[model samples]
Target: MATFIKIVGSLIETLQKILIQGEIDEYENDKQMHCDARLVEMLDRLSKDVQASVKFSESFLIEKIQFLEEVKGIRLPLFIPHSVFLRLLKKKINSVSEFPIKFVNNVWGYLETVCAKVLIDQCGNYPKLLPSMKKATEHVMSKMKAKFAERVVEMIEMEKITDYTCDPDFISSYNKLMNYHAQFLNLLTSYMSNSITVEGYGSINIRHLSEVPENTRNQAFDLKMMMTTYWKIVLKRMVDFLALQLRFFIQKVVKK
Candidate 1:
């Protein structure tokens, strides 16, 4: 068992190294095609190891939280142990595919709401999450134009054309829409918190490395920068103070 764990851990570590280094290479050289092929190889190896391990013990949640954090997106962590899945299987669950399918659907639904809120905030259209083959940009732009046209019609109907900015009802309606979308986001959060996926394998939220776009990369970088600034101001100050106190305590211990 120890040997098995060691092997699996080694594989996971190698996979992580490859992914990290490949991402850097892709970013620096714009060699996404090469990176994508490497990613496919990595995924194939990881999946095979994961399946073999799961057959032996089920609930092995891989300890790679930092990697996910570095990516700047909260997702279903890979390398789940067989023991965890076994526990879920013992719960008399039906339909193997439903859980993962629903999990993906729910995640996409939550992402859609997030997109809507972001679009509204930026005065852009809520973009749909379609399959890789689908051309969704045009559809999203069209939808945004329609939404804006509808808003214009509403403004005219309300007779607040000149002073629409001052109309509380219009603002309230927009807020209400956002709030409704937020409710869906909350549902996803709740489901995740309750370990629905762990309990039933709802969806395997495996984000492909190839899917990381330039815009998303920029957003992730910006978010990390903001977080670093916040942490430096708050946590860093506390840590420094605590370290000083620790140093004084150690000196006292030495004197004794």
Candidate 2:
């Protein structure tokens, strides 16, 4: 019986190590902030086997999820319900350590991809407005890159807290990374503005084209009026409508 108990304990320990290393490897590969808290929780939980330590670690993870719930104003999915996760961990259930790690990692990956796409799409449309989009792009990209760099540093420190060997070179690279990212942002913004100005100026050289052709003038004016009405009624209203929808979704999913 003692040997059997030891064998079970050994299995659990091995599982914990696998989860920790997998998490660290994923974070290193992705450098996203969303996974940072989850990794810390796993690391802390594995570093100690005491019941209280597990509880504390689990609670920390839950608190982060709660914060995400609040920030995005969206509830977590039902497959990984918050209450269920807490109850499972509190009861010392360990079957799904790998599951939680994988689920959260995938969720974060999706978020990162989508957010980046939104930024890029916005950037793509910047050429239409020239300097405004250029400045906004520069501002947003710098803020984003700095935020990412800060997150990477924080994750590296968190790894060290869990007794992982952090690469000093990685931390040192942050400064160079910041400069390069800023330069890239600036270059892209300038290039976009120049391209748009050239294209727009070229289009303007044809007097008939610069002014709407006589035949289509009325149609063009009508189209503009339609757009104005749409913007006033629909497009403008969607901004807060979406926010409220998001908040409602969050309340429904997380309130219980």
Model number with the top lDDT = 2
Q: In candidate 1, what are the lDDT values of residues 51-93, reduced to their tens digit?
A: 3322111221122222224444344444333333232222212
Shift of residue 62 alpha carbon in model 1, Å: 22
Q: What is the lDDT of residue 142 in candidate 2?
A: 48
Query: What's the C-alpha lDDT at position 107 in model 1?
Result: 28
Candidate 2 clashing pairs, residues 3+ apart or interchain? none
Q: In model 2, which runs have C-alpha deviations exceeding 4 angstroms?
A: 1-206, 210-215
Off by more than 4 A, model 1: 1-215, 250-256
> Candidate 1: TM-score?
0.16
TM-scores, all candidates, are 0.16, 0.21
